[model samples]
Target chain A: MPSRISMRFVIDSSVMQAAGRAHPVDKRPKRCRGFLDVVYGCNHRVVVTDEIETEWRQHSSRVAVMWQRRMRTHRKIWRPPPDAIEPLTDAIAGVESNRREQKLMQEDLFLLEAALAADKIVTSLDKEVHGLFRNAAKEIPKLRRVIWVDLDEPDEDGAKWVSGGVSLDPERMLGSSHE
Target chain B: MASRSGRGNHDSKQQDAGVTRITVAGFKSIREEQSIDVAPLTILAGANSSGKSSMMQPLLLLKQTLEASYDPAPLLLDGPNVRFTKAGQFLSRSQKGEPGGEFRIAVQLGTNDRVEICLGKTPKAGFGVRRLTSTMFGNTYELTPEMDHDAVRGQLPLAAKLADGSFPEEVREQCVWRVRQDRCFLGVEATHGDGDHWATFSYLPAEALSHELRNLIHLPALRGNRGRDYPVTAVGESFLGGFDAYVASVIAQWQTEEAGGDLTCMNGDLELLGLTWKAVTRRVSDAHMEIQVARLPRSTVGGEDDLVNVADVGIGVSQVLPVLVALQVARPGQLVYIEQPEIHLHPRAQVALAKVFSRAAKRGVRVVVETHSSLLLLAVQALVAEGKLSPDLVKLHWFTRSETDGTTRIDTADLDEAGAFGEWPEDFGDVEWTAENAYLNAAEKALRRGMKDAK
Candidate 1:
């Protein structure tokens, strides 16, 4: 039998921002190479809608500020893949028909729609808009939900560390309240 | 009005305002009334889906109406389906509570004497009935709902009688040809009367109508490298003939430049033809199938034959050839609708394609191309600046979507003689790179410096 394929992670804006700040040498958020590793390691596809691109563009000035700060650190910022835009756009359109009640803006709806179409996980740290994706996942049969949350806490050795939720064992979450 | 000089050429004759103005309404994105003055050349500029295609509908409708028989389905497909109940219900209703769907095209034609052909809803029939009416020298005739069964029989005697009595017989005959939308009816009209009397209206032949319709070619945006053998159909024979000639010339030019000898043979092999050519060919054998290409000559010394397959050559060349072939094969006086002609082409090739359009336009072809390349637009402006095309002949419209209005507006620009214009849109080219990312980079650098000082 073929192994079951399931999307395993969702990376949000916070994770992207954290990844940008985490570079010890550079202050600029480079392309999320580490995050990309996580995506590849889990055998999952990442999706972005035109709306998400637009939102990121709106904060481009800030991104530039972060980028300049990191120039001396010789750090690189994450850049979206240009050629993959058309396929991503098509994916967004495919989901538009399925999500009728979600009065999401054309771009927002498209992102959710794209996630549904590609059967991929979404990574965004937006608590407010998590419901939109969750609703889409419920309505769309192939879609699954993933969320990114702050996992910075002290371990048994009294050392504070940051980790991904997908990486944390469920048994660990059950015993620890700090997470 | 006859010209004083008897020496008249085809170009000069055509320059005599065959089509004057076109008016469109309730068609696709054009919900409000809009009119375009048909000059020697008219450029339509708009962002994607901003009713630029709607402007072409009047011309398409005219072609359909004049031909003896035509299926309106293809033309209708270009527009939103008003009859689709689900979609229709979703659309906002007009003041009258009707389905708010409507479309009409009115055209003015002739020189020294003018005639107007209007097709759409009349006040009596609402918007469902398609009416064709003609007005000349202040007289009007209702030529639709086709008066009686005889009109449907296609005799058009009522049309002839109306034309002869109200207007000059010649004017009436011209009006008749202008109104008929299919070829067979025009043929019937030609045979029914004394052939000489109908000769003035002879310009409205089936062949001419077909040619005009075929000119409205829409090239798809998708790009592919492998050459698919498109058949030499009647619709594209003239264009194919032109393509063959163009390719032959390119091969000849390459041979002269490379071989330093007179060109005598026409062969498919680019190497023998002396052109910098790359191709992929597939061969079948018992062991396995193979694909390959001949290596490009290095300097003057030729030794080992370099071989590669079609896939080895860059996609840009193969993808671009199809478009060039399609354009070359297109008949003159037709509208070629190309979406982003600059895709996968180098800057040099993009400019070359722009020149091709200039040449095609000079040959009496009308081209409507959509492009995001400033270089292509600049090339067109150069043609206008050099007087190859009149300033009035070139029209540029810009499409801008306003968030406040929730609508797209197409604004026309005036390019001065030097091909320079005022105020390009802030977001014209890669706005994200120039405005947002540039600022982000600066901030990032500043933050990094602060961190260094703290360390």
Candidate 2:
């Protein structure tokens, strides 16, 4: 039998904060830690980026501290990759389309770029980034075949982060002809 | 066969001059006349079946034939234990070579001195030397009136026998003084004057004239990993063949005072594997000997200080023992060919093994190897760049399969003085750079998302 291929997630800092469950100090890292536990149990890896690493280095947030501790113990957290130059440029244009002539932000550009590179879900709670990525599947040829999994919408059980804002089927996202 | 008219006078390449160049045509794998200019240390490398062995096979074949048979008159294409088969085995069938080609070999000894032999096949018999052509280089000299007629008459009969394909008897004591003829045999008994730096221009058989040096000691990758008792013969050459043949006994006899004695050579190599040893070899009987190994005092293992059979310690020790012994025992100025000396060794020791060969070469022992380790290559290059060894002394041939023909093409990856290669390994660099770049991009994306959500 073929070995199970684990899915990789380009985990953002906001999700890490929710996973940290650090607010009242007496409670469990309440929000996204549950989602992480679910993904962790299902053999999903969280790809942490340099930006995420720097933030953790600067603040030593509870979630970041826990990840730092686990870094030595497991191969779960990894650095993220970017979408190719041509594909990334087209994805950016798609994100900035139908908007006022405002420049794309570096931080926002990284999320969309990394999602395409890792070919994984950009597990994010940001709705704007979700719209940007879900639309990128409409522009870039390589990314057109990959769906951006949105983690903002929780499942009815409130325990799992369900796919939101984009179709889960990759076949539906493919066939986007980029000029 | 080409005819040689010995109207010229020059110097014949001496034994001390070393083999300058060896050219082969219709030999195994080599389709045409390929001349390899020998160096102080020449290395032959190519992948398995890529003709690397074919190049070396010629030398080994000649060497083995000299020892395996009494008939030096015949260049036996196939011996009982030799590599190649009949002459047809070496006959080139490639596009560049003739379909049923004859085997021709030439060894360029000196400027104008060379011995070329051509071997052809008949209907019933296999391939053997059909003709011998040689020009022994000697200086200009006019025959004086005082020359001995009696000694000169003796060589004419030998030349007449050579004309009828008869062998020349060994010249017992001194080099022979000979008077030149239009065509004659070049033999040990066929030299001019007292033979003081002077060679006779005669058409002697290839074996009788050149006497190709058999100073080579080839030990095919050893397999004596069992560490069992091996029988040692008290006579002949001390070198053993096979993977691990008599290596234990060799170690017992060979351990030197330099590395603190008692398998010190073996232990020195083991140290590269993060292992130090207390080695002991005992003779069970007149014919039997066994070797045992243990962790040395103040050395590290997993905490048990017990002696165990070398076989039980691990295969790395077993696989490496012969290599260790060969490196230590090989004499100076001898050519040694080792296949996969880094076999079963860790990266640190593999890198260190490259040093062993480089150091061996520096000591005037020509070491040739076929390696599969990139780390070993990197280490050798680093040694060259640091001026530890000259770049000219090192040669790297990367064997790759050709798309045009299925045959292997050897591409020389030249190493500069700074140890930089002309061509980088494909899997070693670009793939790694791409992966690292991808990871960094993803990491940055994750951090950016966290920052936005916090704001």
Candidate 3:
């Protein structure tokens, strides 16, 4: 048997905009596609919620179109449960009064709901998502975790990797401590 | 004639930009992003499960996927090269997350030339060149790290201009590649871009990159020497997992097409194996090919050696034969990844194998060795100390596991001018140390008891 463990991940829209550029002509500093490439190459499951897709459409539609050309429904994206939304908002509110955080809007909550139902990770560069993870970590022991990554930073800088919430070192996510 | 000249011109343009660094992340035991410097000879030294193969596997995966022509070229997990089924089987647990997570790999070809590739899950999973930066006009990053990009834009073009002046007018004026939004949808740009932002240079497609990866001979550690008559196959994939089919194909190729010197080298290796003066020759049947070893009498003065079946020889000879043949035919700028080239060999032959690596490196081939034999390492050191292998041309990486996180930690072993090491890992083959100590202790106790009885 192989020594590696199967793992899960979720990517956000802000990072998707930084997918690879059209070299020579397209001059931009987006290395975010590297993160996705590594995950997929390693054969880990990736989940993308509809709300995240909607957010991606608002900004990184080009990358979304690129995915359309090559996307396959094996372990790439998760089918969010229809009822994941209400429970996620209730879980978040029960954990803390995050009803007014503007940076992470309703779609992000949907992303969180999608995460909880499937036990997927929420990878976001937004501080609001990190705040929600911190709150959920403190108040809701059974709540699923999020992984915060800063793709905008240079490779040599601090915490450019997927850092775990709920105090997971090397940055992993877990909903139940039992597992 | 024009096309051939164009190819030569293009190769000469990028010849200075050799691949320098490789980075692997979220793959197997190598969960953290790790970078390894490529030298003419790189030695990966580690105990079991220390992430040496994991680092090399990323390149092999890409090579195999490209060989199979996997769609989108980089995202497929299951293929002919490896039997990987799902993402979970290989992802580093320390680095992976729920979904939408990814593992990335990048190769820095030179100072300013690099290609980065990423792979994530399926059903929205796609893999290809994530980022590619190159100075097709032969630009290199000779600037200080703190130098501004404005300085790069200023200084790099001047260097490229000065160097590119000697290039043919066709290469100097023509646009060879273009970039669309897909980044890797690159081909010959039929239409000129609207602005000066156009790179107007060469493009190395995913297949080209994969070709670079395929220019390697990866010998897994679980190799064996014994074989019966095996079927022959095509040229490149002939040396698949085991030497059964691969060795026959290799021998057949040797008989029909190889230069005479290849067999001479193989004979020299056989001599080192103490199968003194025995030469390897093949017997072809209607159904199969037989590799036979001939025994030579001590009088090289004037006697012909008759051939016998390779199976008649010890397992060690059959094992080391292909290894020697492979090294003998290695071309310049090729990569050879050997798991344990010293397997099933006597210490002397194993040491001879070290000379093989030194010789291969001297031939301009890059050799990547992952071995458990201290003799091989000592032989390499001896070669270095004797000034046969240059110190700068050699590299060593010591893979050790973290006590707390249980992940791998690879440290570059520093080599100085005299082929001495700054630090060597403790546990490659230290079991011999323990066994020797046990023997000494028991011998001393037995001697003492005998003396007391005599008194």
Per model, kept true contacts as a fraction are 0.05, 0.00, 0.00
User: Under CAPRI classification, how is model 3 graded?
Assistant: incorrect
Candidate 2 lDDT by residue in tens digits, B208-246:
323433545565544545546766543223232232555
Say which prediction, candidate 1 or candidate 2, comes out ahead on lDDT: 2
The candidate maximizing DockQ is 1
Query: Runs in model 1 with CA error above 4 Å?
Result: A1-179, B1-22, B37-43, B57-99, B107-129, B133-142, B146-211, B223-228, B232-313, B329-332, B382-392, B401-408, B422-455
Cα-based lDDT for every prediction:
0.42, 0.51, 0.55
Q: Per-residue lDDT for A73-147 in model 1, tens only?
A: 111122235553334233334444445433342344444444434433344434444444444444444334322
- What are the per-residue Cα lDDT tens digits for candidate 1 across B1-455? 11112212126444443444556665544555566654444555555666565566455444443332335421332321112213233222344544444455655543333333333344654333344444444444444444443452343444455335554655544443333443211221321245565332322212433454433455444544433222222332223211222332332233434542222211122332232244332324332223333456232345234665434555554445445544444443445555566787777767666665665455444456656776677677767767766554555656554444323355655555655443334223223224444454466677778889998
Candidate 1 residue B173 C-alpha distance from true site, Å = 17
- Each candidate structure's TM-score, on Cα atoms with residue i matched to residue i, is 0.46, 0.51, 0.55
Q: Write the per-residue lDDT of candidate 3 for residues B1-455, one digit (tens) a residue.
A: 00111211112223223445678887877778888876657888887888888888777676665545434344445643455766667777752343224566776654555555665543432433333333333553232222343543354454335435444555544432233223222222222343654434332334345445655666667655446554555656223333334566665665665445555666676776566455444546655667777655232654455666777767676666667666655555556677777878888877878877877766655677888787787677668878887776678887887666557888886555555564444533234433433443455566667778888
Q: TM-score order of candidates, best first? A: 3, 2, 1
Clashes of each: 46, 21, 31
- The TM-score, computed over Cα atoms with residue i paired to residue i, of candidate 3 is 0.55
Angstrom error at residue B155, model 2: 13
Return the lDDT, model 3, position B373: 83
Given candidate 2, what's the lDDT at residue B117?
58
